[model samples]
Target: MSEGDRDHSTGSGRLVTGAAWAALLLGLWLWGTEVTDVRHGLSVPATGDMAAVGRPAAAELPPAAAPLKDARPRRIDIPSLRVQAPVMPRGLDDRGGIDPPPYARSGVVGWYAAGARPGAAGAALFVGHVDTEDRPAVFHGLGAMRTGETVRVFRDDGTVAEFTVDDVQVVGRDRFDARQAYGVRQSGRAELRLITCGGTFDRASGTYTANVIVSAYLTGTGP
Candidate 1:
């Protein structure tokens, strides 16, 4: 689909995009398992051996309600492809920010705050649909992204976190894995996962059968 002809039905109403189904599966897999020894290259600190490095003791807390103090994201820009969209925080009660109404003709990117923050200790997620029933969706070109591309996320604090594309994969709707897409950790550096609809459109299901996931990692911190 062309950029302007993109679809946005996935995030609205009863529409369930392939990405959403993957997220649900990931959650179900994490219900009774404990993640251990997450590591990246040399840059990320080792959380499993905090005491070996002489760090003070830290208390454990419930995973679902873990507290975070990073700055909220305010804007998202992809310069190489000329994409600029205002960022909206999204969470329970729509606490983050209201995304543009589905099928909106304007250029507005949406954030999924129910996920994690980029460069933080969790999986940061941003999602947009591939198309609307009548027009092009905001993330139509997401599948064309290549490795080594940069995606800059501007935050409310005036700092921008830059991430380098590491990998991109397409998952079947019924088999998408959320933990691999949203919960994996590489050191302590912030990670990002961008999602959009792909694969053949099923008119009967009213959604696509697969999701395209673009994974990246923080490369630098700057203004």
Candidate 2:
């Protein structure tokens, strides 16, 4: 190739490369900042349709036996993963999904206050952030929880709701089944679900592509 021709080709290549980098950086900025709709993007849909009746029951049916007295959960300690974080009462966001703890308090977990309370005969929901912008958050290692592992929740009533991990499942955002992930599996059983974002991060959406749902049931109650 002639020297002039080679120089021209190299300059053109550099221009294309630089343009690609600029586009990539601009895309990330938009993805991260404009991802405000993620409140609804968490998982659960507007119908709250995690039910077999084609609509969510007002709530899960309580067990045949009376439910344990409601005790507000204060903290959750997952010893197997060494995850201990404060529990905060959280309600639905504008999108009708469980609002998460503030990103500034990423190390904490949010309890769905309107849902079943811990140790009660229904599903108690807890949600946390897996990571902050650059650091691991409260439920970062929750995927490591194994069957039969212990989860302890301390309450204000001086009793601890001890749960036995039943299973861990990761559901992709595209295929999230609210019934399987959040609905009560065994009628009347005191159940728990620890949820956090999982799967790959979508640069365009600025959200995780899946969710890690850890299911458990109350096996024993203690002080």
Candidate 3:
């Protein structure tokens, strides 16, 4: 579970920044579709040189549900991974990159407050630490998710926005393209992105070699 925590310390800034976060933030701002085919294979892990987990050809996903009204996310539940955690709103840092949840709060997920809310019609971005100095964090199992799985977002509007996992990618730092990673896959649909440090922990660069991006879209709503 702590595969990427070796030699890392709290407040080290190596894990988050090392995952090529600056490039990710840069890509987030540009929102173009210069490239989209970033998937590598079905259920591929974000370890070693592998980049993303492609959806299976035979997977029968549900139709997209109409987007809900804007609401602040209160919590997120990923039953397949047995992860349930609070959602915190985060803003950009002075350097224009996301200010992710601090290491001390690695168990929670950080949402880009300035962007679309989880159940709204744009890609709502959430980021978390893969591992801390001693244990795996909230998104540690994110890369293992497969298509058709459910990602439920509890909102302040008293509704549960259920999303279906569609795509998973492990975007490498050198080839990091914002359009490919953060760009909307389907227009007018409510999408969710869960990102975390992935790939191997590079001792030389003091950061992870890549990032894991999980894409899901709203499929249903519940009370």
Model 2, range 1-223, lDDT digits (tens) per residue? 2344335535221111111111112211221121222121122211111221122222222222234678899999999778888999987654335567766677889887877788887778888877655677788777766567788889889989888876666666566655556656566667778877766554443456567777777888777
CA lDDT, every prediction? Answer: 0.55, 0.62, 0.76
In candidate 1, what residue range of length 10 has the lowest lDDT sum?
42-51
Query: Which of the two, 1 or 3, has more TM-score?
Result: 3
lDDT of 3 by residue, 62-97 (tens): 999998999999999999889999999988776677
Clashing pairs in 3: 27-178, 51-170
Backbone collisions counted per model: 17, 0, 2
How do the predictions measure up, each by TM-score?
Answer: 0.67, 0.70, 0.84
- What's the distance in Å from true for residue 127, model 3? 0.3
Segments in model 1 whose C-alpha atoms lie over 4 Å from true places: 1-69, 92-101
Arrange candidates, best TM-score first. 3, 2, 1
Task: For candidate 2, list the clashing residue pairs, or say none.
Answer: none
TM-score of 2: 0.70
Q: Give the TM-score of candidate 3.
A: 0.84
Winner by lDDT: 3
Please write out the lDDT profile of model 1 over residues 1-223, one tens digit for every residue. Answer: 2222225434343343332334433443332233334332222111111222332222331122222347778877777557777766644223222232244443456566655665555567776666665555666667666556788888877788877766656666666555654545544446677766666676555656676777676776678
